[model samples]
Target: MWISPAFHLKVIRAYDALVTQQPHPGAIDIRDPKQLAIVALQLVEVNRDLQAKVDTMQVAVDAHHRIAKASAGSRCVTDAAKDLQVRPKDLFSWLSANRWIYRRPGGSGWLAYQDRIQAGLLEHKVHTVERPDGTDKVVENLLVTPKGLAKLAVAFRTPNAA
Candidate 1:
């Protein structure tokens, strides 16, 4: 995947921090963008995995909004006990990279949904029918897989579960 130069720099900075944890003593040149990009990408990738977990947990938490409304606070007293109200921007930032994660735009209603689109959750169905405009054409629908679901599940664990 191609990344912008600014983002590349951001990744490198992150990598430098990680590298500092190890023992390496040598004078090195720093004019290679490709080398830097690789290190940066590696750092970004690790954080991305972490972010996925945060995203899935956010999704599950926000999903409770609907249930709260249905229960009408009869089971709980405090507002915090009633709903999981995660902000939409936070959720989107965590999930935008992976296409299968879907949710509504804000922290309001309970119109949220997520599905694994790779190879484990496996929730897709194929259908071939005439186009909506009545044209003689068919469209393919990609479905999510079980592997994707498992990945999401890993993400949904409590925030500090080590």
Candidate 2:
């Protein structure tokens, strides 16, 4: 019911044009009631067209959420970040604030939270990487479960944690 300033001006012009038979407004003799009705009908048709578009968009968003929840799974942070088309820093921020991941003293990378690991919502993995100098190093990372991934996705997608 909130009328914008532009729309208010349009309504005023429509009323003036329909009711006052004189184009410049000093009273010409030919007033037609049907002209006012036609203007009102045009406004109703425009409202209906916009409402239809809003309804269709809502249906598509609901379907997307349902599929995202059902298809959640365990994935490495790097891969998950890539799949979501977001920077790794944003994903890490959500993990850190929620305490679903942590870092050990002097630890070089992220680790699974002890509680989530025990609760079967997360797992840990170790892999070896070879450097160009022919040296090998072991790295640790977390594997998030379906339930955990789905919940975390909600947080990461929501704006400002609200």
Candidate 3:
């Protein structure tokens, strides 16, 4: 319940207006109950307005926190597509069309673009697989980071705005 200096100034101005009966600054008469009541009501009105603004700001902060929580970690493209409410194939196609990802020459797996990886929007997770020949093959999987997921969510919601 911290009151700003500006709010304090507003209350002080209201007190001065009621006491001096003028459009300028002055001290209030502590002995007069009627003047005190008018100033009290003005202060209450100002407080109510400030409270409304604070409540609005609080709601925005809460929404931001919820979005941050929902987009907290990187996920595979399939899981990311589920979060975005789009099919995995559609998501992959969109990413490819938008130049966010691509397949290396003669490769099956998708790879993130260098710029996307540098921008902290995408990442790579490498794994080693054993083939029938008993040899380990290194594979890289592309993943969307939390920041990228949030961006994609907004892009998917808007029509032709991404």
The candidate maximizing lDDT is 3
Q: Please, what are the lDDT tens digits per residue for candidate 1 over residues 48-133?
A: 99999998676555444334343331221122221324344543444445554454567332211343433333343445688778
Name the weakest run of 10 consecutive residues (lDDT summed) in model 2.
153-162
Write the candidate numbers in order of decreasing TM-score.
3, 2, 1
Clashes of each: 13, 0, 0
Candidate 3 C-alpha lDDT tens digits along 22-82: 6444567767798799899999999999999997566545434434655568899998887
lDDT ranking from best candidate downward:
3, 2, 1
C-alpha lDDT (0 to 100) for residue 132 of candidate 2? 89
Alpha-carbon TM-score of each model against the true structure: 0.26, 0.46, 0.55
Given candidate 2, what's the lDDT at residue 136? 98
Global lDDT of model 2: 0.69
Q: Over the full model, what C-alpha lDDT does candidate 1 score relative to the true structure?
A: 0.45
Output the worst ten-in-a-row residue range by lDDT, candidate 3: 153-162
Can you write out model 2's per-residue Cα lDDT over 1-162, one digit (the tens) per residue? 798999999889878888884375544334666766776788899999999998756554543464364446677776666544468888878778878788889977888778988887678888999988999988776877655655555445533221
Name model 1 segments beyond 4 Å from true.
1-29, 75-162
lDDT of 3 at 24: 49
**Each prediction's whole-model lDDT (CA):** 0.45, 0.69, 0.81
Q: What does candidate 3 score on TM? A: 0.55
Per-candidate Cα RMSD to the true structure, in Å, reads 20.2, 14.4, 11.0
